[model samples]
Target: MIHDQTLDQATESSKAKKAVLYRMVMDKHTCPWGLKSKYLLERLGYEVEDHWLTTREQVDAFKARHGVTTTPQTFIGGKRIGGHSDLRTHFGLRLQDPKATSYRPVLAVFATGAGLALAASWAAFDTPFTLRAAEWFVSMTMMLLAMLKLQDVEQFSTMFLGYDLLAKRFVPYAYAYPVLEWTAGALMTAHALPWLSIPIGLAIGGIGGLSVFYAVYIQKRELKCACVGGSGAVPLGFVSLTENLFMVAMALWMLARMI
Candidate 1:
């Protein structure tokens, strides 16, 4: 009797591995996310029943019938498992908080800028790199960050006021901050006008470091960092502080070399 019961339970478990995925795959454009969902399901050992909607009308009809706004909808044991991200959550794979702030945008900008600097260094000076390469990397990163802020200066300024002591006191400083950073970065990269670039870097970096420390550590405020842009999803923490410290270090280094 016990052996028969175990066999029945195993059979039920095997049956539960069956899944259905309804997705859009039209001629003009097949949904990339839909393909991702199908791949995820198959990789997880599910026997997927793939239903492809080949026309826009068919896609619309399917969505309407299912009362869902988006496709690649999944069903497991006759239960809706939602989209790709949702499916990952169901499998305990995705642990990200949807509302939590991230430093990805800033990190990406720094990474790409650093790569560009290294490439420039290799092309100009050849092998073994140098301290100058590090300087170039920092300068280029600053320029990129400034450009991101310049995309929507008004929005950036609004977010900037949250933690920047100068911005909070003098609204115009917030508006002018991106331009100052850009000018400093451009001059530093070109190794031109050290007088202007060094001062700007030191002033901004010093003020920024102090403000970030006070807001993030002293006050312990959980606010968004405006480092990358005005989106305000980047958390105010180590990454933000590090950017300022890098600026300060670079400025000091340049000053010492000049002296």
Candidate 2:
């Protein structure tokens, strides 16, 4: 008896989610956003009345009647639900704000870089990867970051000068920074001459650490980090500092191992 009652209640709940979706479906072109809206409505458990305006005249009439310039308009219980984005809001889904800065790009880079490192380690040395793999990961991350900077070196240098003490004093350092990072990372990854790689890594990483510390902590300046690229929106804080610290630690470890 209880099971039957629950089934009936769920059926009634689903019945209440009725919606009307009016979208363009012409001979020359079927609206892409219209399909998206229909998919979203159906996914949200909406029993949609799919009204297709197959002709241009029909589409214009529909738009004029609804006082809307766009197709793929939805209506629930006689209330207009607008387009794909509007339906998303109606269902309480979070949308990306174009005006806002996000760290997703940088985070994606780190995640991909880590996966590459782990894969490389597994391929080179079977199960239970060693500390050398971690070193490779750090070196690879630096190389990836350098590549991003090299995409627009001038822009990167400008952003770097904002928080980098060395760059601010010697503008030429900003231009040379990416090249130095690339060289150091490549040399470290290849297990090349420690005499060159270790000192370059130590100097750059140590300076970067101090610069990040002073900019974020001491001076308390709110700024974007140039670590991932000048065009990126990655915030200047813990993550940026961690990148510098990783370089410093790797360089020191390599130096000690050599000694």
Candidate 3:
């Protein structure tokens, strides 16, 4: 992502050229998802200009000014590309096809384990026999989540790969969903609140929905994602919706089963 000042300079310089300007309102650390998105786009050969906006007020202002809501909000050719998740599907769908092997399973397993761990911790420590074991569990879960993400070789590849617009856009959104799973799981574990994970899962599912929504728009226009790093045939739009819907169902089931 280009610095705000640098973006301004480039925009001014490109006044005579047909250059597309993009912006992302995100925090650097907590929203590591945004960073991954930026990485994907850059990897896919797109020039992206990013800006940070932390508060809901800031997000609102961007939406009011640009007429949209969602984080990692993006604008291209002076048009809204929607938010981070939207862009992720946009780029992924543009790719060729899914490889025979995928890291998605690893991610799913990690998430399930984290969730079950939290449930176990809650059941065990619910009584007064434990000494702040909940806190310890929470911390450990958080660490595990971070470690799980870091363990993915694909993430490291996505991070260090050359900059592509599709890649830059997709990486953040793709990486974010999994991270959210872990974070929500960790938070639920920490509080020993299994019910909360349902909402959190639903929220993550919503992100997938957003991506699918945008993908349909892209497909209707017949534009392919340029962001796929080496992965081919990115599934756009409604595919994301299907995935999200499945996630929502799974989360609901998990909640019911656990309770």
Candidate 4:
């Protein structure tokens, strides 16, 4: 199964807690996994025979002999334990799947926004269930989402360009989007400058909702959203659409207040 090691082979040897590690220690680069492996082995109370392949020639020869494409190979009682992942598996440790779809970040962000709104309401009116609190929940969420995208604008823009209709066409709008969202959200939260915030919110929200609708709901294509940021794994259909619609609603609400 894992690294071609059977259960018996993968199991730690009972005779002696000893491991042989072959890793790179070159001038320009040292294998991080190797260091991790060495540290893990040492922490586990294993006597590690740390062998450093310093030169390219030595590294190549070692790889050729072991039939391994990468270094940081571990052997326990003459059983090959493969790379860092394989080693982790051998020890029954948890490993994060980078490609796994997760909604935790989005959920956390929204939850935080709601909590902050309730707290602000408590501070302002001595109650957490005010109409103002409801408004703040939406506006604060928008600001939080904008803040996340602003963390790495370039990555957000790249992700935005992939699905956003306006970004796909104008391109520069993708880069300016986070700033616009943050500005609109901040003004809306403060209940200031409805004229500017309303227009910006309406424009971006309308375009964003349309884009999400076209790419996700209509086409039935599952896409990762750029709403919260590129690093997060928020789905594009319902949540993304909701984000846009919230802005539209907030903008309209601001307009109604002015009227």
Candidate 5:
């Protein structure tokens, strides 16, 4: 009926902070929202009385008693806080949208690329800051981007074909784009086969950049970028254009090395 959050019951901070959480922990399925509600209460310094509805009968009975339809209900100081979303509202926190477009994936890729570049610099040149770091940053970002695309090439290709000029005209190009990007990034990072990598980067980058500009600027079409993957929420705009431009710059920089 009641699950103690901790071994000792002495840790209730204040009457105002005290919360009661009712959740389900059935044999086959444990309610996630219940877990979240309990965690949120505990983290917010509430001494939560975690009540578990272990059986369907218990759940139904509890719901009927409370006049509520959902499990994982909370009550603060004898006042029902409703569900998890309702609890969040009580704390003035914004509820996240599952379908909202975000730049988080792009930010993560760039951050990873920067970190990898720094590590590569330290290992190779005995310093974190070096000209090679910039090169590696671009190179690593491209590889990471490509890797995400490669995970579901069909999904990425389908999304990409909507805006990518070459991919739209020649469907095969959509599938090939990720492979080409990965190959170029890998070769550039490893400092292997400049003859191949440089050209590959240039072609894909140039085409991609132009397509993004045309779709976002010229056509003014609002679309989710497939830059991360098909399921990603990155918007098609400057960030996508910048990704393409970075690849082009890296390719040119590598080409200039030979000259």
Candidate 6:
């Protein structure tokens, strides 16, 4: 049933390639779905606005504006696109959008190297209470990086297509990093095992550096960036050199401290 008022507004609204304002409740699945739609819309040459309507007043205003009472509602070109099912209907089958970037280990490596360096510097050189604070910084950085990678709606479909294949196909085996870094940085400061800390930090840096380098090689040879989070700006050969060198530097510092 078409509401006269809704139709009138749809027609009357400025014909400037209308924006889609989506209203959804704050929930685990709904939020991700909503974000995915927003990203898809952006890629499809549309501007989409997402609002979490948790209050009655907000919902009322939204209904008045868009003329839809049911939710996971999407307003595109002043027309309503329903829930997840509706969104799927819109996309049909080209879910992956082949041009979309895949997750790359190089990006993760770069982010990790920067994070570890910051954590180590703060933990090693800062005041007495700074060790624990540095640990928090490193853990939070690693966790946040992982979260951002997970939230990349652009890669949503590709990730699903070859979960098994891609899961093991990471350029530099990047998944082992967070634990290595968090543990290395924590042990270096907490237990003050200078000898152990050198090796641990070096290992963390070494793995990251090698991964980024290989990613660069793959990128140049294949003309594809496998690093995640749209961070292909970092070239791998340089990234690898920088990372390995950084690890070696950290090892030297740790060794000096032990001596």
| Candidate 5 per-residue lDDT over residues 146-226, each given as its tens digit | 999999999999899999999888999999999999999999999899999999999999999999999999999999999
**lDDT order of candidates, top first:** 5, 4, 1, 2, 6, 3
TM-scores, all candidates, are 0.83, 0.77, 0.29, 0.69, 0.86, 0.37
Model 1's TM-score against the true structure: 0.83
Q: Write model 3 residue lDDT over 111-149, tens digit each, in one string.
A: 554565566657777753343443334334334534544
Which residue ranges in model 2 land beyond 4 Å of their true spot?
1-16, 20-36, 49-72, 99-103
Per-residue lDDT tens digits for candidate 4, residues 20-110, read 9999999999999999989867655678999999999998998899898998899988999998888887776667787778788889989
Q: What value does the lDDT take at residue 38 in candidate 2?
A: 83
Candidate 5 is scored at a TM of 0.86
lDDT of 6 at 166: 30
Worst 10 residues of 4 by lDDT: 1-10
Candidate 1 overall Cα lDDT vs. reference? 0.85
In model 6, how large is the Cα lDDT of residue 126? Answer: 72
User: Candidate 3: misplaced stretches above 4 Å?
Assistant: 1-176, 183-192, 217-232, 237-239, 255-259
Winner of 1 and 6 under TM-score:
1
Candidate 3 vs candidate 5: the lDDT winner is 5
The candidate 5 region of ten consecutive residues with least summed lDDT is: 1-10
Cα lDDT tens digits, model 6, 1-259, are: 2244543444344244545656556443355666666654554455566668766677678778766655667676666777655754654523434455434455565566456656666666774345444444443344343444445534422432222123346623344443444455556445466666667667656655554455445444333322233333333255335534555565666576567
Q: What is the C-alpha RMSD of each candidate to the true structure, in Å?
A: 6.3, 5.8, 19.0, 5.5, 5.7, 11.7
Predicted candidate 5: what Cα RMSD to the true structure? 5.7
lDDT of 2 at 174: 96
**For candidate 4, what is the TM-score?**
0.69
Which of the predicted structures, 1 or 5, would earn the higher TM-score when compared with the native? Answer: 5
